[model samples]
Target: MGSMDRGLRALVGIGLIAWGVTAQNWWGAIGIIPLFTAAIGWCPAYLPFGLSSCKTPK
Candidate 1:
């Protein structure tokens, strides 16, 4: 993913995890998906929709 996209994903993931941790809810664990995507620079959900922020290699 692009820098901005990665940053946003990281932020959101952290936010979700924090919220989940604080609330002690399973929903917070869902943040792992975005965190993994941010770390890997790939979003599986975006694949089905044909969406991407990463730049193509020349």
Candidate 2:
């Protein structure tokens, strides 16, 4: 969830979205949604479990 992680996540999300749209597959778009969460540095999927890879020095 650091800056780099956020950036990478955003990039990956964009890629997924593009692929999804180009492939005309709704499932692909659905898959990209998680990338958006990661890009924002806040994952709902991880929230419940309190998981994070951020290096903010606690």
lDDT (C-alpha, whole model) for all candidates: 0.91, 0.73
lDDT of 1 by residue, 2-58 (tens): 999999989999999999999999999989888889999888888889988977889
Instruction: Encode model 2's per-residue lDDT on 1-58: one tens digit a residue.
Output: 5677677777777887888889998756764775877655676677788877777565
List residue ranges in candidate 2 displaced over 4 A: none
Worst 10 residues of 1 by lDDT: 46-55
Candidate with best TM-score: 1
Compared with the true structure, model 1 gives a TM-score of 0.82
Report the number of clashing residue pairs per model.
0, 0
RMSD values for the candidates in order, in angstroms, are 1.9, 2.4
Scanning candidate 2 in windows of ten residues, the lowest lDDT window is: 31-40
The deviation in Å at residue 41 for candidate 1 is 0.4
Clashing pairs in 1: none
Model 2 per-residue lDDT at 56: 56
